[model samples]
Target: MTGTRLVIDGVTLTAGAYRLVEDVSLAARPGEVIGLVGPNGSGKSSLLRAVYRVLRPVTGRVSVDGTDAWSLPVRQLARTVAAVVQESGAEFDLSVREVVAMGRTPHKRLLDGDTPEDAALITSALAAVDATDLAHRPFDQLSGGERQRVLIARALAQQPSLLVLDEPTNHLDIRHQLEVLGALRRLPATVMVALHDLNLAAYYCDRLYVLRDGKVTAAGPPADVLTPQLLDEVYGVMGEVTIHPRTGAPQVTFLPAEPHPAAPTGAEHSSS
Candidate 1:
């Protein structure tokens, strides 16, 4: 199989003295789109960093296609995994095409230039993300959404078997968000994405792992996991989960909390 199998076994992540994720175990089959959905500071980004080798876990392991990811050489790991993190700081001034072409570096020898195949891949990647028109622009000058599309194009150009993206839809418009996620769904790579939009996750992901306070609160298909009680407990909100008639995916609608009673009038407070 061309797709990669991802197994995150009993993974725990920490930052210095602070623990970020605890005993989180998840798996993504070849070509599957798995989602990590959670509130802010729930350790979604931390776990993703472990998978992409940015942050090593204090305990447990991340494996890609049955090989321990931590044991792989840096270049080999890059060839096997591509990640699009939320932090998009451009250290150097480069054209969008130049940035996308960087994805070919892991496969090339020192001082090697782009082959025809590399060029084709770069072109296709831009098209896949709807960034073809911005290819000639300076990456630093693009808007947040534009830069996001370009970065995704760069990752697509890498053609890795496993793709890890931290909020790939961040800063994108509604149409582009759907388009970008739809493109990801068509790829052959095994994808793991962190998303705050539960409805989008429900529609796109094959399975979901919900995190809360750095612990996994639920894991299963969206329909099985996204109930009103789960939403209330995990998110502290009143929500309704229904199966979409056309898509058959769980649809979530959050209800407003009841208004608090008006503060006591000044005269009443004075009387007290």
Candidate 2:
């Protein structure tokens, strides 16, 4: 009953005069991992902002469990939804554990100190993200991958019903990328993640939505959404799609486009 169902109804996202995503309707059922995949500048992040209540849609609303998310108080909204954004900065010189502990804020009263239960949750979250060693490290001192994991740990500590993340695998090594996505896959919360990696999306997401020119051009199970024609048309990249032998998920392998004749090769350019 704690898990949330998300409904985005005809959301038209915009920035100043630019229309990012228009009339877009999307849903994430409880315990579903829904992915948003698109090339850069394709409104993936923009759409997520609306779901997290950071960006108000031009003409529509986002609902969590059938209640308007934008109408809720900020603290109440935070209790139901947790977001791990791409640009989580460490301006304050806090420890990694301290940063993760901030996730418990919504659940505590104004003057409540950390309880034993809170401490236990924090410890468990750090361990889940493999950030136990960095718990005492200064937040600003960690590397990009380290910060990403720590931020994810912080979000996990929130224990929210809905989780929203943008590019959760950026800067991570292949192993950690798999680790992070795998963790997301195992969570009971409704997950909405934006990813550039098609193969990862295919592996982790229950459903995939392909965004292009600020619109969702295709949506379905990965096997149906990630076809060669769709990849070529939406991404302008030639790709081969096949079933992964182990997981039976769709696997995408990008092919090199035909080289432009006018573009010089390294040797030709050096001779010139």
Candidate 3:
């Protein structure tokens, strides 16, 4: 929790005639895990893009530790914040070890040499994600989940203050999903993860940001923002919100929507 505090003030993003995200503001303190949740196309990804500098915001600012993130040099930003995005394709068939070593690029000079210390750090990162066994394996040959873990280890090798993950659980099994997220929670770095699974988010996140249609529908602790009414209104579904008796965090169970009447047959429609 040293220097990871981030503040987003009135951030807005646009694409041509469309406003993808508008007036999104939030603050994340050091060592906290914040989950960004919303339906598909709700601008969650767009907001992430803005934060990561892949897409510049149309207005407002993103600040980290009282300094404008945009003002930081690209290499400085890479050293401070590491990200694991949804789509990462490796065109070259590098070994897993080689891939993980690339995380050190931000710290290296144009012709700087990597010492034995750098190699040891890469090995440590591989061990952190349980990818040491696959270090020698070809990256292209590993399973989807294995690749995901290696990528995560690569990000960890950066030793960043802020770690951002967009859909890290995309290809993971339930057990691996929990394992990855649990490990992330145990890390000291401040984290912001975009998650689709409400149950997982409820289990791991210290705070939540619920986005709907390019704006924040609710922002607070899970118990305060994830009410049944809010879920129904934002997600178009009815669900029960209950507290985990042990943890006291909000847990949601979705209920089926009521059925609608069937459409009239073609013959009946013609007669009408």
Candidate 4:
């Protein structure tokens, strides 16, 4: 189960005439897990939108497996890339299996019915995320974490070569956050995830791309990229970076913002 190489080459994305992300380029080697980290509105999700073909880059290109992704038919692209976004558009009461079965759409003709193989893949995807018990539950009724797992199961069933997710750990408990990310890293597909947690990003990703104000500020292995100076600059917080004993990955512990030295009190500022 080899994965496709993902390349975002000098891509610039815009909303109308306003550029949201500019001249961004990053690569995920086949089967590598890459994390995008930054503050809110830093363009992590905007960059991901371009990669998943939701938002076309105003300049440059996105390529998967040596071909321009935008050039392929949507169906062909879907076969190669599957994304789990923050929200599920399925507003109706679809059961988990029914929702997961939607992933098979890329492989089926408009009128084709689910085959035994499709059933097997659906089952396997659910099991992969430990969501088998939720299979019969209404998608709308499940908690945010449960829904995240199911949506990921749907993406897995698509058998894509590259998997993209935006904040896949949102609303999940700490344990499930690790579980979900751990499963993603093990997948035989290039993964590009937009993450807000620098520590989690350090733990799971093979490389990191740090973005600020719609542009990439740094890119490298977690240990090299997650630095004190960069954190102070990008996140406006004082943080100490240390290597985790178990994973050997860089972990960031944020120190609280110190109060401004209280204005010279009383006599110091007094005319007396």
Q: Evaluated with lDDT, which candidate comes out highest? A: 1
- Residue-wise lDDT of candidate 4 within 75-163, one digit each (tens)? 99988899988775667579999999999999999999999999999999998888999999999998878888999999999999999
Candidate 3 per-residue C-alpha lDDT over 1-272 given as tens digits, one digit per residue, 9 for 90 to 100: 23399888999999998999999999889989999999999988888887778878889999888899999999999988998999876654799998999999998999877789889989988987778999999999988899998899898888888888999998888887888898789888889999999989988999999999999989988888889888888998999999989877778989877776789889887854
For each candidate in turn, the TM-score is: 0.93, 0.93, 0.90, 0.92
Off by over 4 Å in 3: 1-3, 258-272
Against the reference, the lDDT scores of all candidates come to 0.93, 0.91, 0.88, 0.91
lDDT of each residue in 1-272, candidate 1, tens digit only: 14799999999888888999999899999999999998999999999999999899888989998999999999999899999999867654999999999998989999999999999999999999999999999888899999999999999999999999999999999999999999999999999999999999999999999999999999999999999999998899999999999999999999989876889888887853
Full candidate order by lDDT, most accurate first: 1, 2, 4, 3
Candidate 4 yields a Cα-based lDDT of: 0.91
lDDT of 2 by residue, 94-156 (tens): 999999999999999998999999999999889888899999999888999999999999999
Model 2 error, position 129 (Å): 0.9
Instruction: List the lowest-lDDT window of 10 residues for candidate 3.
Output: 1-10
Model 2 weakest lDDT span, ten residues long = 256-265
State, as a TM-score between 0 and 1, how close model 2 is to the true structure.
0.93
Q: Worst 10-residue stretch by lDDT in candidate 4?
A: 84-93
Give the runs in model 2 whose Cα sits over 4 Å from its true position.
Answer: 259-272
Model 1 CA lDDT for position 86: 95
